[model samples]
Target: MQNNYFAAAPKYQEDSSNQQTNTEEQQIGKKAVFYYKMVAKTLGQYLSIYDGKTEYKMGVVMHQPAKPDHQGGFYVYDSLDQAIFADVPLKKDGLYFAPRTVIKCACWGDKIEYPNGKIAFEYLCPVQDMGMPKGYLATKAAMKEAYQLYSEKLKLKQGAGPKSLKKPTWKN
Candidate 1:
């Protein structure tokens, strides 16, 4: 096996306009600055699920349980699922549980042909097709519980988890 290493790189650019007399900056010609990035720890794998009714394409990050049993659940997010489907990268803050609002709504549009043959369209949520899932960001234990109910497989009393994550409920 090949050994690998990672070096943290500067994540933010220096502000040229700021002239604070910090001792480090005063003594050094230049310095590399690094910002901490918070990775979204699992409610297990991040995914999207279609609720049969109220919720549309609800984006969820859930942790499915392990072994010969049953039971599971999922925390709900009213944001970013559309953005994820639209190829938005996971933010530095990762998947946050922002309450559902118009800001997170994605839009769909159609080709409108004017009388003169000019075509136009706009992406706007029809409201009727909007996804407003219920539930809050679950506590870690809650996430585990949610997954238990949703996933078909049950967790063992004690053993390792499966090698790969289960697929999302809907295609990205």
Candidate 2:
């Protein structure tokens, strides 16, 4: 399969004179053109760089910040396939996805598979912000289990009203 991707090329003639140098340069140019054609054929329209805000589409380059902090830097939407394909570094603040985007997990460094069979690593921001990637919440079954746990806690609290009331409602 790998061999099918790269065909064996004919050996070049030895450059005995300066005119041979021109032939060598032509060969190099031909090889470059071939590579460009291959890239265009494989990536097609995805090869184009997206210009505008990340909100415009998934794969657009949002903005590159001048000063990078522990939780602030570059951001982009997942729709910008070229940015991800190029392996662009995420901002220290982590890559931001649109709210409607489905996050497979909240944990940083998790691998998320795209519909096209491409896999991307998740980078969560250490600090919470408006553009931070949102965590995935429980679905139907998990939500049901959470509801059951809440009910059980309520039952336990009813048995010890004054004692339970003394405890803080918010969790640490």
Candidate 3:
């Protein structure tokens, strides 16, 4: 799939006088976007997220954090499909989630597969911020498994390309 640029429109460059400089936040912002894109190319491949019209982003609904990195109490998910998220006018709103059928990240807490072949993940990270792109307990398992597998394949001297030529996670 092509890159899903940020939720907002891109700000193009202008003349040198008005050109944009890379501030720390800007750099981190770019890295964050890249990290999200990496997610799309790797674990996203195993998911059937594209619903024919709108390509819903993988949104993580988390519980309160307490024991881990301490970034929490922001998103307390009580429902699989947020009422505000359903049938949204394609790509217009960014606060919504794909549904229980999508949003397959392990960081969502606990993954539950229904009998209808639709998968749902619960928001269970009450003590840790499972929202981080990496290093978090949840991301290490199913989240980045595809990337890890692709890396292992590359090490065997096999003519293997990336699960999309995936890049390493951003560092501060």
Candidate 4:
């Protein structure tokens, strides 16, 4: 079984930038493109950084074909397979019918098989951030960098560093 992961196109909103608005289409100004790209860049970086790491668990939900054995029931594969007896297309767009499954994780989990031959597993998902990548060392590093940058901006705004704590000169 092979492991396959994919990233979908970002969902863009017309009013995301709030610069200009069209009553007919309700579209915003040109800033929306930049804003959308920024969001996509951040998300792409987060995903890439996450995939580059070794300590992660992943899962996928795919559409299976109609098999005589498992008729009507869906099929889940260890990896993406375009050719399967019980394969189902994921999207409804074109006639290709490629399965529109979501690989929920970047790694595998403990293998558990059911009596009915169905397989189940758990992925390496951190508890923080509500089952997403949180508490990972790399994630922590990324967050630390972001925090440092924000802290620097805050210092510039306040005209003082983060250490400038206003301790009461005279105790109450």
Candidate 5:
């Protein structure tokens, strides 16, 4: 456990230019309509599923019944089924509904050389919304923070965890 703790040292140098570019990109807004929505309470767990080998991030969103035995018939649950809906985290806000607990979307990319040649590859992050009872909003925020922290852990020390398999080519 002690050995697993994040290193106290800083990782890669912070590129102000890259940071500015990311800020611009985020301002662009959502480009697609997600089909899921969560209540902002039932958010249960936030995980960063990594394939150690591939380093692909999978965002999962999961939801369960609001309660058991206490059936609120002829209502939303009755219509939506025992399973509730959770929105994708990468949306304007976590407001949609879905059956899963994770949402994996492209976050960033890197350049690498494949065994055969070279290419550019990218990876995405995962978001999970639990939509708990009355803590939907609060839980959602906490989950987001959890994910953010998970990401920071990776940034704690760069070039040591996972490297991309893509290679970039600049043409004149």
Candidate 6:
């Protein structure tokens, strides 16, 4: 005969405080930087983003629910060219249709709900395919302009001008 001292005891204490802290941390870490809307078509949805260096193609799953128990819906592609080249549809369950968009974020594994309150998707950081960082081209252009202005100012200080110097050799 053995004495069961902990048989009926709670297997583990429910730490509500820890759970609350975790939820808060998760919310703080899951902020979206930008979002692109992708309308689903009879075939599928596609999103192409060029961050000046790389092109990212984010595909959307169509005619399928995020979960087995989720309500069915349809998404029609807005572009005729895309509709013509979309993948084959899987299921035709719901008559209600709308465009599904993918939210882009810097953090991976972040989840966001759709405006319709029906679907949610996990955000994946596509940094590898993100190519150049955002605003890189614009910043580059600004820097180039500033350099040109500085060169012009230096030339002026050196008593060089259109009347005294030859036409600026550098092309705009």
Candidate 4: segments with Cα more than 4 A from true spot: 1-102, 105-139, 162-172
The clash count of every prediction, one per candidate, is: 16, 5, 1, 11, 39, 1
Global fold similarity of model 3 (TM-score): 0.19
Q: Estimate each model's TM-score.
A: 0.19, 0.20, 0.19, 0.20, 0.18, 0.22
Which has the greatest TM-score? Answer: 6
- Give the per-residue Cα lDDT of candidate 4 at 77: 34
For model 3, what is the error of residue 103's alpha carbon versus the real structure, in angstroms, after optimal superposition? 2.3
| Model 2 local distance difference test score | 0.29
Candidate 2 lDDT, 1-172, residue by residue in tens: 0111112222345565734233542453243210000011111121112221222212222222323231332223333232223332333332322122221111122334445433333222211112213343223344467888888788666664455455566678
Q: Which sections of candidate 2 miss by over 4 Å?
A: 1-56, 69-72, 75-158, 162-172
Task: Give the residue spans of candidate 3 off by over 4 A.
Answer: 1-20, 23-25, 33-99, 104-172
Lowest lDDT 10-mer window, candidate 6?
48-57
What does candidate 6's lDDT look like per residue over 1-172, in tens digits? 1112123112434385654233432453345233322222223422322111112233321122323233322222233333223332333442113222233323223243434332233432222122223332223335578789989988877768576564555678
Global Cα lDDT for candidate 1: 0.28
Tens-digit lDDT string for candidate 1 (1-172) = 1111111211333468764444432332133211111122233321222221222222211122221221222222223442222222333443433222222222212323334222222221111223233663333345567777655355422223454544334566
Give all candidates' CA lDDT scores: 0.28, 0.29, 0.31, 0.28, 0.29, 0.33
Regions more than 4 Å wrong, model 6: 1-139, 160-172
lDDT of 1 at 146: 79
Query: Which regions of candidate 5 are displaced past 4 Å?
Result: 1-138, 159-172
Return whichever of 1 and 6 wins on lDDT: 6
Write out the backbone clash pairs for model 2: 58-77, 58-79, 58-80, 59-79, 59-80
lDDT of 6 at 159: 62
Better of 3 and 4 by TM-score: 4
* Pairwise lDDT winner, candidates 5 and 6: 6
Worst 10 residues of 5 by lDDT: 72-81
